[model samples]
Target: MTPRFAITDAEIATVVAEFYAVARTHPGLGPVFAAHVTDWPAHEAKITRFWKNAIQFDRSYDGNPLQVHRDATDVRAGMFDVWLGLFDSVLRRQLPPETAAAWSTLAHRIGRGLRFGLTPQNGGPPDLRGPAR
Candidate 1:
């Protein structure tokens, strides 16, 4: 049977766009993302492609988030809470509950992975949870 939550490109774009609109200005995540990404439109498109590949299995994204976060001084384990919070809010607002659940699972997984990878002192495996309401 088909998946209960199947996301479309348009949905991905909408989520990414709306999410960044908040994240870019968020007190915690805004500076982190801004310090790293100089081009907003390009970054948004890249994020769109990244989520599309992740959620849709399109295999279109090529960038390395692990490396990027590792190199950035602003990325940290505690910051993921802020990032996931914003992402959860955007997903909850922009998509249906089932679809948001499916997408948030991936986002949480990515957040946990990035947090661990970026923190050299923390090598434990990541425990991914569904997005916050």
Candidate 2:
């Protein structure tokens, strides 16, 4: 089933552009991200594909985001928080309330999963499960 509130590619691009603009304004992340994304056209295309897969569930993206993030060692912890905050702000400004909520939830889950590896036992099993009942 299609979502009632769907965001288009143009919308995603707008959000991403705004996000990069915000990053550029911030001293902590601006220099690092700008240096890494020296090739603006290529970086934009990659990010566009990434977000397309994220919001639209496109199957073409087979990249490992965890590995990518790990490779970007220059991305400090605080930068992640700032990035999320900027994303949330953009979603709130651009998307419908329901869409924004859903996207925020998804972003949070992805962030958590990336920061802390997901467990195969489903969150390490419930404490009250009593040793696999």
Candidate 3:
């Protein structure tokens, strides 16, 4: 059988819905995220566009994710972990095991990279990684 490279819009919608539900239930990050994403419809539209472009190369998205997340400032290190966990949960619930694993791996790497880039180097908040002795 040929490998299936396509994911349906319904699958994407399910994942997104599950993701938001998890985010809303997350301990520390939930309230902050809910407050920030007040415009659910707009946020959903943007996110849908993002995923569509990501998986299908349909260049309909036009937002700077790095800049937006950087400006959010509330997306701390632990929050990244929570976000990834939710993403993994949604993928697992909606897709085949192998597909979920692959997607989760990619999402984890991207999330980690984004978090690392967003973290600022300063004496303000103690460095995430301690200095060498």
Question: Highest lDDT among the candidates is held by which one?
Answer: 1
Which runs of model 3 end up more than 4 angstroms from their true locations?
Answer: 1-4, 122-133
Ranking by lDDT: 1, 3, 2
Query: What would the per-residue lDDT of candidate 3 be over residues 1-133, giving only the tens digit for each residue?
Result: 2222467767766787778877888777788788689887778778877766666566889987667877786767557887887788789889998777766765666676667767776223223222243
Pairs that clash in candidate 3: none
What local lDDT does model 2 show for residue 66?
64
Each model's lDDT: 0.81, 0.68, 0.71
Clashing pairs in model 2, backbone N/Cα/C closer than 3 A: none
Model 2, range 1-133, lDDT digits (tens) per residue? Answer: 3432488888778777777777777787788887677877666667777777776766556677666666777755445667788779988997788878877876765666555533333442222211231
User: Over the stretch 1-133, how does candidate 1's per-residue lDDT look in tens digits?
Assistant: 2322587889999999999899889887888888888998999999898887776657779898778777787678789888898899999999999889878888888887887877778775465434543
The alpha-carbon deviation from the true structure for residue 60 of candidate 1, after best TM-score superposition, in angstroms, is: 1.3
TM-score of each: 0.86, 0.75, 0.80
After TM-score superposition, the amount by which residue 89's alpha carbon in candidate 3 deviates from its true location, in angstroms, is 1.0
RMSD (CA, Å), each prediction: 4.2, 6.5, 7.4
